[model samples]
Target: MQEAKTILTKFNSPTRFEYIVRQASLESAEAILNLNLGGVYVDYEPRRFHVAGKQLARGVLGGVTVDNLGSSGLELQYEQELKGVVGIQRVELSADGSTIPTEAETIRKAVHGSDLILTIDRALQSQVELELSKTIQEAQAKGGIVIIQKPSTGEILAMASMVTTETGEIVSTSHNRAVTFSYEPASVLKAMTFASVINEGLGVGTSKRDIPDTVILEWENNEGNTETEIWRDEYEYETQEMSIEGILTHSSNTGTIVWAQELGQQKLYDYLRKFGFGQASGLEFPYESQGILHDLNKWDPSNLNTIALGHGISVTPIQLVSAYSAIANDGIFVAPRLVSHIVDPSGNMERLASTPSREVIAASTAHQVADLLTSVVENGTGEKASVNGYKIAAKTGTSWKYFAPEDSYEMPNGQRDPYLDINGQRHYTSTVTGFFPAQKPELSMVVIIDDPAPIEEQFYASHVAAPLFGEIAAWSLRHYQISPFKEVQLSDNNQQAFNGQTIQEGGE
Candidate 1:
């Protein structure tokens, strides 16, 4: 009825929609064949949803596309573009169910699925996956994710994830964590506040303030009761006057909150949403998370000062990267994309529309914030993330993993992890995100390490995520041949790239 059928063609549907159940359970099949009840035999249908066999990328590839051909989902990413119109056929069949080609004539030809030209670099994706897996093993942590993007074009070159399954297996996750997973982003979000403050002309990167050891956050709760929360630095510190750059470089929780209070609630919240928090990143991936952003009226004390310190708010890795990408792209927030374009059957390629982009901050403000972040890598908490000659603009974040359920974090298998913070919960997400060669940004990357070991030390973003960021960024710089700036200061631990080889000057 829909046409496009080949009348005499002896072929199956070319949609690639329903792949065969290649990895069926051998046990079930054997049982079915050997079934015997004395002189009588009976057979039963196997379980509807059980796949058994080795999968090359059981998790990684499982999350790809829609249906049995590769994955399982009704709404696959760009399914319409991928699933070409099916060609129809009308052919006579004998009693044996064989097609009678002699009695049939061609009606229409089936159109094969379109080829998706993705921005993801296969080699880079593999490298990222390897590094993420290695990091998970080395840290002895639960799992992690890494993403690499081009600032100017919003093209995602690579994204990889490994997660702890319900069965406690550390394997590549079936879902793209970059777009789906949301968590408190800690200090990596400080850039947003800084960008806003600078955009509002309230402060500059070098603007100095007398920071205190602690600040009391008092605000009305959802119940209309006045609530008070104390905001303290991760480490003990006396009252000190520090520059805005210093506050971010050191990632001072109290210092950030104190300044964020200046912007007021409405302004701060506005900027947060504008930066793409509490909203889906425009990447438009299937099942993309918008992250948790309460309405302005629904905000509590935590949403204010606490959020300024990168707490209380939830954000996806894609959102965080896109926000930073705006700064790297001269204040333009270009939504990330996986597929570059699509190619039709006739080899005619249909270029996709431009990625959603908007100017989040002025170019000058973004530059100022970028410079501040550069200081972070050069002489702040993100030192481990620095490349010797490349000025890096980045931030380190380590926040207590917020488990909504009291004293329990839910597992994938519908089980709750029965552990509290005091019981070696080790619930912490460490993250680092930045763009390199700060003067002229090229690449933006985000590294997230979930629950690194030794809570007292390795759980810190600097120790876990920063080093990984440096490793991957260093490799990318060399691979992409990105030139470095003048030799002003050389890194100590970061003096080398892949192996013991000294990292030469980028200009070299």
Candidate 2:
């Protein structure tokens, strides 16, 4: 009776109410019948208001009663939100079992939630993804990744992956290779080794250990192979009397291993772990792998040599880049961050900022490391990474491997064949990691190109990853207003050159 009174007084009497009911009935009936013209009879029958569509009306409006009505959109996802009540039953049955509705509906309770606001610039992310995809595809490599982070705050500006599935579908895998996959990092570890020496007050600038610019890595004979593994010649060509700076400038494996030896296994492993090598960076990922760092007690004579050169150790790119960021941040190590904040529809903001960076070393020591790394890009293997008008500090790495159950540097016939093949020619995964505006750093990035085709065309990091670093850094520098490093005469050319202002130089 109350339902009848309410329908008569509030829903049917008013012209607008009648119109709304008519429209809803028509739409609902047609939807059920899947036809507009055939559903008029359905609306004509005088049916009792049936919340569960189980009861007939006592009488029709003007001798006509609509049988059904339904809601849409928001009412679809949460019908209870719109004061929709469960269909009640008043009668037992018609030919088909049915029930009449009699209840006042109430809306469902509202649910509270939150949203996230990220610091990643859309344009910058797009640039990095596009460039990284192009490079990896052109290389016909398995897959690759690039990550750019601000050195000061450890804010990740851009990250992209060109990961391919086992099914041959090239896609972005859920795994963040930059932070997850940890592998033996050939010569890239040299930076930390060099930094550890400087921090220990070794005074690399004036060490009097008769440090040869080149050292023949002396190893024992192979267990299976007939090849005798004696001390080979120096890995790279450089004067024996060159300074420690000269070792890193040229990315000398033997030179770096020799220096790390000075630090010794115990101290070197300590510094490596201190630099965030053997643990996760605590990023928001489930698959982050803690890289392998053998305890000093576990080190054999060979491991000491190889780990010194970054072969016996394993590390993720994030660890590697974060370690580099320590140098860029003047000895402070900031945790790498992704999401900057979260916001709701009401514009309520919940900001998520990186934790305060911890001081890993003295600022002076960091500066010393930066000074040497700067030379690496200016006149060394990373020369290809130099930006025209910016201070670029970089290191290039090409790791060699032999086909075996475990990693071994026993190159076939005393050659470091680090190249793989794609399409027809040989390829390699060349990596270049560094930061820009080296004097007052802003951005740091790592470019990794895996097993690129056209090896002769684009094999080394200088040819593959360095150029990419230059492009990304130059764009980022201009966008961020980072002051460029002025080209100064760090070395006399075959003839001569000038520093910024003075022309006083000699070489000829």
Candidate 3:
């Protein structure tokens, strides 16, 4: 029996066996013998013991499993390949009722499950999660997500999400906030607005607009009564004529609205759709969201203004990041993917083709937009997101959560009025999305911090999300050894350029 156990242990299959116990003690063996002698077991089937245990993606693999099959992740998406087929065995027994080993036959061979290889870089993913966890804790944020992708191939390299529990514990959930949580993107959508303007031949050069600190617009109510509403910027700026680049750098809500108006409602809508907004990202994740791009027919005058400033419309972080990837990849929108390929038990590999690419904007237009984003990190609200040596093209977004009234407002004499205050206590979502090596981006990423507390000055993306982006980007660049700007010989007059340059910067 000991020799048999030793032989079995030596032949144990990592792909098949759940666990194997060797050199069992007499007490343990007696427990099984007692059960057998008690006649509680009708039949002792060795085949049942040989079956494989459920193998699931755990920890860093990061996929969800749900009771509803439709909502499951890769477990359901590739169930046929992952589950594999069960087999049957038949044996001819002698008159003594003992199975004859020589007469045993396998009616069907058990097919092993195919191995799914993802595009995720385990090392980079680890760093992303570590940094994201630290950032969320420092900001006392509810949760956060970070997505790193190869801009050229649209392959996701790292995706990390962390949530704070009510008990004040930070833990990782299967919920991929990057592709599932959709919210008003705030100023980050300014990049898309600018892209739309440039794609339509509207002009890359800045458009002059007189931006005011606040603007009051008159509109007819549903009851046919004239009403007025005020739209104000977060920071009061004097009314002055400024260019499109200037608007983006300053992240002016009034300026973005002006540009959206010039682009017109239908054209802007078209551009949004063209950029893959309001559609599934084709990442093949079960819970991926298409986001909320309001229908054109439902567009109100204010919708255009609000949507332009990234308020009226909502978008998943993946959607926004992929859109920026389009700009980085020279205007071609390539759908991002996770599972790269699958290797079957027979050793055959099936590589997944890249998602269909469509031209959203001209290459020249993309380059122009990339330049504008470079300016954003260098001289704009995203300055904090700048890496020491590498040029990062990024945009920052800070959006207020939409408030829903718990009950209708009562008018004079206890009469209920139709009005409900839509403005609630300020809860903000701060985000930063961009690509590095601005001239030739290899990595495009987005970081989102949801409803950060201790909101004294930490509510803004530049303060919270942008710095997180910088940290993660800096770490990723170092891990991948991504060279920053090419080394150039500094002339005597240009010696200051290399003064503070270091091979390694910005990582613990």
Candidate 4:
């Protein structure tokens, strides 16, 4: 038998090298080269790293892979750890430009990258993604984002986003919209606003005050321009006399604004900062948005009232979820985290330290806020989000989608929400966020449904996002096998205890 080989083409470039070698009469030309038959051998180059879990959380687990060339999501945050240092070598060649028959001196050995153990629960993420896609489809919505986190540690278990494109195709966007997409977060923000008031000792949970449905506000700006605007609730009604709990329970816009003013702008701004708004999420995920936070100096006359109703400001889903997580964690704000551990090439595992955390409010204050949120779910707008046997503490937000030019969420006029066109038809972003079990919470979540088809009186988050939150929360409870009938006593410990239950404490 005769065998022949030919170099059909040779190519080289700064980024790569290629040789089109053709081999005839061989079962495996590449294998033969690798076999090093006779005195010949093939010098192969090191391989580039590839990513895993592409089928699930592809956008979140993005890294250097044949599938994704650029750094994104978790890959972007842990690039250096995932991609080891390149190796270097020193070798001598003969006069003929061939390597001498001697071992090459290694100038620098390659260091393998650490393997990342993420906080994501594969099964839960899969389920959340499916449900989010289904919810968007059923609502005839533009897109949606859902996130599940361990409130105590701020570990994200599942984060998913899906969009139905203009062409009517369901697709996961190139970016992790959960961390990247920012919008007016509407009524869910009411909880945070009220939280500020309660934490500052300006008002207690049971404090009562009259809240109006509409208010004409006027103020001067840093630009020395006097602005006059009218801020109103989604519905028309007379002034409401209620306590802080009743206000949040009914999702009263005026109620929140009234208290915010009582807390004062500086304190409101300071508390919002403590809640993780307008700041990096610390995950350092690629292209994470800090959302739109206007400086206190930039506040117009109506900025407070408008923002209280979830306009004139924007927030990423991540920032919003982390804020809720703080309340769930007994007022401790734990920075959200993705990677949980790193394993070296030698198989030695090193657990990463927990993310940065600080107490943003007193435990009693957090308890009061959680109780109020629990009431929202039990008797108010978030009633639809209630799951059987679970005391879910959550709030629903329904806000119009600000239709404007690129990077233009600012409502300078602050007189009218630009979310509606000339015809009075509107686009909406609906959201529901909070934690489960109310006390001794285990999980926190935020679900946002973007631009759902506005049906009269049905565009509210109570009708859109809350139901979805309930569905997923139910499934998550079953997945984790969290006993619905758990009983733990408060330290006060007596015949009458926390939740009126007396049981032995349990630990994981």
Q: Which candidate is the best by lDDT?
A: 4
Instruction: Pick the winner on lDDT between candidates 2 and 4.
Output: 4
TM-score of 3: 0.80
**What is each predicted model's overall lDDT from 0 to 1?**
0.76, 0.64, 0.77, 0.81
Ranking by TM-score: 4, 3, 1, 2
- Per-residue accuracy of model 3 over 294-367 as CA lDDT, tens digit each: 89998866777778788778899889888999999999999998888999999999998878889998999988
lDDT of 1: 0.76
Which portions of model 2 show Cα errors greater than 4 Å? 1-108, 164-170, 205-239, 344-346, 401-427, 485-508
RMSD of 4: 6.3
Clashing pairs in 2: 47-57, 48-56, 48-57, 54-99, 117-341, 391-485, 420-427
Candidate 2 versus the native: TM-score?
A: 0.68
- Prediction 1 TM-score vs. true: 0.80
**CA displacement after TM-score superposition, residue 334 of candidate 4 (Å):** 0.6
Clashing pairs in 4: none
Residue by residue across 266-361, what tens digits does model 2's lDDT show?
A: 778878888887787755444567888877777766676677677768788878788888889998898877667756545677777665577777
The candidate scoring highest on TM-score is 4
TM agreement with the true structure for every prediction: 0.80, 0.68, 0.80, 0.82
Write down the worst ten-residue block by lDDT for model 4. 1-10
